[model samples]
Target chain A: MMYSPAIIAEAVVNGLMTGAVYALIALGLTLVYGVLHIINFAHGALLTAAMFAVWAVYVAFGLDPYLAILPLTPLFFGLGYAVQRFVIGPASHGSDSNILLVTLGLSIAIENALLAGFRSDTRTLNTDYGFQVVELGPLLLSKPRLIGFGAAVLVTVLLWLLLSRTDTGKAIRAVAKEKLGASLVGIDVAHVYAVTFGLGCACLAVAACLLMPTFYVNPRIGQAFVLVAFTIVVLGGMGSIPGALVGGLFIGVVESLCGLFLGDSLGQIGIFLIFILVLLVRPTGLFGAKA
Target chain B: MLEVRSLRAGYGGTEVLRGLDLSVGAGEIVAVLGSNGVGKTTLNKVLSGVLRANEGEIRFDGKTLTGASSADIVEAGLIHVPEGRKIFPNMSVRENLELGSYRRGRERRSANLERVFETFPRLRERSGQAAGTLSGGEQQMLAIGRGMMAEPRLLILDEPSLGLSPLLVEEMFTLIRRLNGEGLPILLVEQNVVQSLECASRAYILENGLFALSGTAEQVRNDPELKRAYLGM
Candidate 1:
């Protein structure tokens, strides 16, 4: 079974588009982990909720999913901030394990809540542009996916700028490295933690908007992406932003190529196989915390 | 000026600072000298508001800060340069300094930064480099220099001389003396009895969570028990 170069190019392009969204999903996860040192098991559930928000907005107001990004990002940011500041912060009480358990419980609670409200059926917005495709030489790329890749890149760049140039970003990095030192400088560790968590959820909202056009929404839809996002977080290193981005793309390509050779269902194993190999070799992750 | 009355703090049934009373007046270099595990760190933690005092009143510039968070303490201009020189390892030297004025010294950042660079010219040379890459002496200098960026009303340096070479330790004291000469009150917390007494206007020898001896530098240095226990006289 020989594949032509055109097929390979198309596969690579497809992989990149998928990988871009994966990176966006992972950006939030990595940022939270970087600052809070929490695994954030609720991430997928949060994504599911955001997707539902997009679906509800579209169904109710006939608004475009792309337009929903504006309001939802801030809305989710507030929700995440409140959850971390009021709920997670007090409940965790300065314990790492407690935070992890809380996030896990949050994930389960959110899943069940969404299940009760929306049921188990998958829902998707059938936008006019959803079926459109871009003809790129020998490749016929899905328009929404192409936009997802470009928007994802734009968001990544913006996020990078925010973290590098803003006062809040500096405080976040400071707290991530040294909590007591950050507080000593009047950073208000709890505030920074909540802000980081908010930024993370905001990223997920943007991702949900982009995903809704071409993807389905369900209580379990996010579960499909969250595990890969976690693997990307670990593969890229636990807290490194660039690591998550690069790892997401790399994993996407691996999955695509493995599917090409090993079939789709079995190709999923490619991600885990690489994850194991990376763990065995680097241990800290690629671009992880700077060796 | 900063004042503490009978500060008592501990961790989980093991009391570290019990009934400790101390004060630092304006423009005074007050040294709290204690050996390892004698509650110097605990005192720093309590003052900085990282650790809560069990029963005490801390008045800084006439405002109670005993129950305040570390942010409030910092906002009150009681900057703490903690032990182990906890500089953000991955951030650049310049960033670490810039973050010093994050709450209080924002208006004076450029000027204070210029002054700090002038004071620590070596730090200026490596301002663009990662702080973790700096030598121990430089990191200690960075920690103190960071506190200076805050323009603190009272600067607390916890074990600033730890891990420095003997010559560098002397140099550190000279640096502290110069900083104090500029009329910034300092709370010099250390285990270095000889140099601390030399640099401080007054000194207190802390032992077993309480001050065993405290008075003017001359009085503490000439005390018989202090010389016998600490200096092996």
Candidate 2:
């Protein structure tokens, strides 16, 4: 197929922006998986729930979407902690599959609850900046996309620093490696698990708030992003923060290029094809170690 | 000082350590020796708070530690280097050592890191390398070094010699002796009866979840039953 320079440039920019959001979504799932050893299938539904929460706050109080995140994060953090402590913790029992089932059940329960509560209507955050666009040479960048990308990068960087440099971060890493050994070294494994899940949910909180301005929200919308996030998490290596960042961006660029060169349907299939290829080449992903 | 009385523990319905009693004096190197499946590791697990006792009293430095959380137990300076290395395979050697002091050693993390490096200089040279890549001997040294980073008053090592080369096994014994020389008490759990008895001041022989024999290392070493059962002499 013949490719125009303008089309390629637009595709690249679009992919980068979409990839940023995917990174944010994957960040939490990977973190939870690293420490808790659970796939956390409900993670996508949680993001959708957070989006709806933000939407409710914005539509009711006329608050800025960004400001809604401030209160929303701590709220979701508490929700995540409780979910782990009360629901997920008992079921875990050192079984990986059990946790997966629990999370999958949670995903279904959450999506259906949202469907029952809000119906299947697509709702977008109608901020003034939502429609605003910036033109640089032949490329057009939406204001919301730019802001979402920035927020995703900022949050991911902050999480990386937290996991690498902080005391709590050390404890989280310890538990991830060896729960019994971490306990022997005086880390509360249960507390670490709860807090890690909370932090992961907090990422979704930020992603949901920032993304509302860029995309429409509905009960089933979580599936669209969750699949991409899972692919990024696996591609980046399960627990590697930097890997997630690079993987997200890489997937975004590929998706954008594919959409431009191939059709949209083919582009998604191409993304999955890449996911399978990465798994075959390196099961641990780019940064992950073997399980 | 560490004292465990009537400590009862097991996995799922099968009691591995049934009302076991043991004590280790300050600055003493005591070994718990037994053949495979005698619950030597189970005793370490109960002592380190990794497994809760079904019934018993555990006192460390006169503080009742029964049912206490593992983190609290570690904070109290009771550290356990588990049976397997259990090191964070993905983390660098330095990171694994640094994590050793996550609870109570946070203040002296750098200092303790240096001390561990001194104890296992090879780890210092490969501080940035992933721990899983280390040779078995080096991994054993890393495990011991990680335990040292906690500044443990009473260290429990569960099979530090397991899967080590003959030369490394000798080195492991020497390292235990050196750590004991520094006034650090150790509870060495092992199936290598003869070697463990050589380094320990006191030795306890466990059989079927009970202490079959207990005395000074010399006395336990010369026990005819132990020699017949374990040494195959």
Candidate 3:
């Protein structure tokens, strides 16, 4: 197949746009992994819940998805915090497998609850301005994708600043690096874990809102996207923020190019190939420090 | 300032600090010395609330601390500078020190940080560097400095001199003495028999999870059994 330069450039741009949302989803996953040392298989389910919650708000109050961010994000943050404190915190002291089982159980329960409540119907946000396009010389950028990408970059930079500059952020990172060391220095590690989980959920809330315009939400939406998020997390190196961004973009481009050149089904295959290659060649991921 | 009575603790079924009794008075430096795996570190872990005591009572600054969360223990100012220099490897020296005051000394954090820097000039010089990147001796200092940041009422130094050079060991002992001279009570748990005895006002020899010997530093240092086993005197 002969591809023109314009098509290639369009694929690259499309890849970056989708990659931004992927990074948003994976950031929470990696943050939880870093501090709690748990894989948080339920993270995707949590995002699905956030998507439904935002949709509910939009439907009930006729609020824009972007405006719903203010209320839904904080509410989900609290929900995440409570879940960690009351639910995950107890199992966290057990073996890694214990947390794994617990989170997996939670994921199943959440998906079923959504299925029971919302049925298997696909919910889409009917926004007025979603299809509007912004042109940058040769490239036509969809308004929703541009906004999602901007929000992703903004959140990532803000999270980086929070982790590097603030005392609470330092405490979270400290707990992530060394639990005993954190406690020794008077850090309430249990509390940090809960907050980190909450923060992770908050990121999901933001990602859910940004994604509402373009993505269709269903009970099993998490299952569809979470696998891709995991790929991004590993590709970006387990706890590195910048790695998540770059990894997302790489996966995005691969998906777009493969879909364009081969077929839609082959794009999914291409993603797995890259995942396997990264695992085989550099198990630590791109930015992961030597374990 | 610190007391433990009938302390029975261990990893799981095997008891490490079995029915042990010990105490540290205010403005005193007490050392608990033993060879590796003799439960010196275990005692620190139990005291710091990391390991649960099967049956015992621990009183710190007139309040019972047994079974308290590590956070509450540190909040009460009984800081444990754990063995192996467990500084946050990914954090800068400054951040490591700052976290020391996270619970107890948030108000005077800057002041305490300056004091810690003054105490360990090397840590101050490398304040921006990651704790993991520091040399062994520097890491040890950072550990102790991080401990000091909490304004500990009674500092517990667990094997501070472990993996240090001979000269650095001497320097560590001297630093311990200097810290103690400031009227801060310290519970020094170590395998270095001689230096610990020299710096500590009193010493206890732990063996097989029990205190085999206890006396003034001089008495424990000159004990025939101790000399035969530890120093080969």
**lDDT of the candidates, in the order given:** 0.92, 0.89, 0.90
Worst 10 residues of 2 chain A by lDDT: A177-186
Q: After superposition, how far is residue B90 of candidate 2 from its true place, in Å?
A: 1.3
**lDDT of model 3, residue A215:** 83
Scored by TM-score, the top model is 1
Q: What is the DockQ of each candidate?
A: 0.82, 0.69, 0.78
TM-score of 3: 0.96
lDDT (10s digit) by residue, model 3, range A1-291: 888888789888988898899889999998898888889989989989999988999899998988888998788889889888899779666578888988999999999999999999999989988899989888888989999999899999999999999988999999988888887776787788889999999999999999999888999998777899899989889988889888988898899899888887887677899999999999999999889
Give model 3's docking category.
medium
Give stretches of model 3 more than 4 Å off: A1-4
Native contacts kept (model 2): 0.76
What's the candidate order when arranged by decreasing DockQ?
A: 1, 3, 2
Docking outcome class, model 2: medium
Best-fitting candidate, scored by DockQ: 1
TM-score of chain A of 3: 0.97
Q: Write candidate 3's Cα lDDT for B1-233 as tens digits.
A: 89999999998678788889999999999999999888888898889888899998999989999999898899989999998988899988998898888888889999999999899988889999988999999999998998888898999999898899999999999999899899899999999888789888899999999999999999998899999999998
- Candidate 2 C-alpha lDDT tens digits along A114-160: 99999999998888888899897899998888888998999999898
Clashing pairs in 3: none
